[model samples]
Target: MSVTIETPNAPLADAQAMNEVASSIGLDWVGMEGIALPIEIAGRPVSATVNAGIDLLAIENGQKGIHMSRLYQALDELTQSELTPALIKSTLTQFIISHQGQASCAHLHFSGDILLSRPSLLSEMRGWKAYPFEIDARLDHQWMLTLKIGVPYSSTCPSSAALSVQVAQQQFSLDFDHQPDAISVQQVSDWFDKRGLPATPHSQRSWAWVTVTLGQDAAQFPVTELINRIETALSTPVQTAVKRSDEQAFAIANGQNLMFCEDAARRLYRALNNQCHFDQVAIRVEHQESLHAHNAVALAVWKRGSHAA
Candidate 1:
């Protein structure tokens, strides 16, 4: 008589719902992060990693962990449509709606690259350039959107430029000190062809990482316009496609736009200040020194009036 009675197929208890703990004292952000999803940026399908979170107060400590699965599902549904400011706002709103009275703020972060065809500096050829960009959206008492980008350009040190010019002058005097007549074209060309006759300034590939927050006046994300302003301000953006003529032109541009990290930061700080749409701007300029072992770095922040951060 050792027959076993059949048990019920499933558990009769909902552990996650019934097992409740004390409330959290203060949790600034709580949610899933590094969620890999496919999203559309600028009408192109791109892979994006999403980080979403919500603030948990002491009154609502730990019930079921803020329904994290709901936040993930909301973002996953957004991959079907192209990412825009409106979509971000809607997604953040959905988070609050789904959480009801549990969450007061919702935040989302995603990053991807935008591929663009950039025309050559001097040639008619165009080449593809991939620009890494990131967007942050937060919905609480107010809505905020921020964009960040990294621009690479050539940086020639001011001191190096002066020294290079002096070197060339010394070499020229050594070659034609006794000549009474002006140097001929052939003679100047030969002087240039000589090895190490005119010292070239030391220039290194540098980077500018800029983050800007849009004020209420801004309607759409001005990605292309922001990129243009940065590139034009630096004046020595790295070239994509190059020919002999293009290389020569680039050399002249570099000579004209010689800068240090301080100069680069100042240039961007002023440029961003003039834009009404940009309320707060953060600039970081890094020069990977070709001559020195340490890098040159400069940082500047521009905030509107007394609201600066």
Candidate 2:
């Protein structure tokens, strides 16, 4: 019988060797990033493909770059079953411990689309849609876990309604001015005022970026709930499938609650402040206008007990 031998490449072992070399030289922020991996979202088990950016930062000034190989080796330990919070916590804990607590900080960036089934209003047809979402998680010596999320939504301009009404009324008045049987401009204006006519709301696609951090021994926070709050605060969420009824309802909802970019930002801030999950908060919202060539943006941050006005 003939015998054959094979050699296996060990990335983790290589990483450890690299870590030792970097440590001997004194380095900072040694880690591997932009790694692609599949994950589960909304229980559909879709690929959580993310460009995982990992950084291990040191507080002291004497260190050079960190042991990049060791960091990569540690990340390779992650498997499908080891992606949960407990697993992540343990991973981070080991990272700090393995580095002799020299690297006091770690950050992770993960993103994926949430594929969902939305029912059509008339035909009851199931439509599949993907909503893009991201998670920015970080750990520090303070035992803090910060998570950031970006949510896409839509906003309607209530201020535009008043202007639309004025323009439409002026046009009506000009056309009927010479007619004897035509109602006067005052009458027309009054009619529009009473019926809220001639008022058209302007709309734009909007997005909100929310960040939250927990204190040591902090209560459990459901990231999904925070996302839901942000969507609700924006007043209008992106629809997967639209039917006649859905379109009509959307219009009605927007008409009742028109907002500007500034309004959207404040609304989100208020919603988060009221929820009071973290001691500090930051919010940013942008409106990609449909009528203009440029986009409008608003931002707000608060660290005090109350949100900024």
Candidate 3:
């Protein structure tokens, strides 16, 4: 019978003395990443990949490294309940307190696709939509938080609409072989009924990515409101589970609200600028043009102050 000796708990590798040279340099950020964390947002358990880090600027001369496990433990303890602004602030506090005199900064980054239900236009039916979102929270001398979201919409080119109208007028002249002063109203009506449209404008799928610095209660992300503003500004949103009526309404809206990349960016800029809750806002509009092989992109930023970021 052989007995194995248990490893002693004392004199651990973490308890070893630090090298003077190695202990002198301060680390800006050090900690865990890709931590599988489930956060509760708006009563839903949100699966998030969290990146937690902290600055070891206050490390004493004798200390070689800060305890990385402390940050993870802080996250685990606070996240067991739920994720909220207050909980985030508390977790950062725990990270600083765990180090006592070593750490002065803490940051947490989480990103995931949140599932939300959106109602169909001109229909009572609703469908689920997954929106990619990112939330970044930092704590140091002050606290900061920002949220980013992606919104997909339709962009009808103004130039393309004008050109289409011009071509349709020429097509009408050729089809009837008569001028407005000579053709009867009944003849024009019959021609329109037989031929659906002389020419159709070219449009393509588009996207808008927006970021906002939040200054209010962050218990829930304002994804719906942000999406509404973006779609309203552009006047043409990509439909989900589109019915015939919804498709017709969408086509009419697209025709009424023709825009280019620059127009899209400016409209979003103006829409976000009116919101007081967002301290700093930025938007990028991407129009995947069906007319050209290249995409048209525009970015705009607006701040609460005299400048933009």
Q: Estimated TM-score per prediction?
A: 0.88, 0.73, 0.87
Candidate 3 residue-wise lDDT, 88-178, digit = tens: 8888888888877677898988887777777788988788776677888899998898888888889898998898889878888788774
Local distance difference test scores for all models: 0.83, 0.63, 0.81
Estimate, for each residue in 88-143, the C-alpha lDDT of model 1 and write its tens digit. 88889999898786779999998877777788888897787777788898999998
Identify the leading candidate in terms of lDDT. Answer: 1
Q: Among these predicted structures, which one has the highest TM-score?
A: 1
- Sorting all predicted structures by lDDT, with the top scorer first, yields 1, 3, 2
User: Candidate 2 — what's its lDDT?
Assistant: 0.63
Could you give candidate 2's per-residue lDDT for residues 86-200 as a string of tens digits?
5556666666666664667665556666666755434555677565666555567445455566777778877677788787778767656777885767986776676555446
Positional deviation of residue 35's Cα in model 1 after best superposition, in angstroms: 1.6
Predict model 3's lDDT versus the native: 0.81
Ranking by TM-score: 1, 3, 2
* Residues forming the 10-long window of minimal summed lDDT in candidate 2: 13-22
Over all chains combined, what TM-score does candidate 3 have? Answer: 0.87
Against the true structure, candidate 1 reaches a TM-score of: 0.88
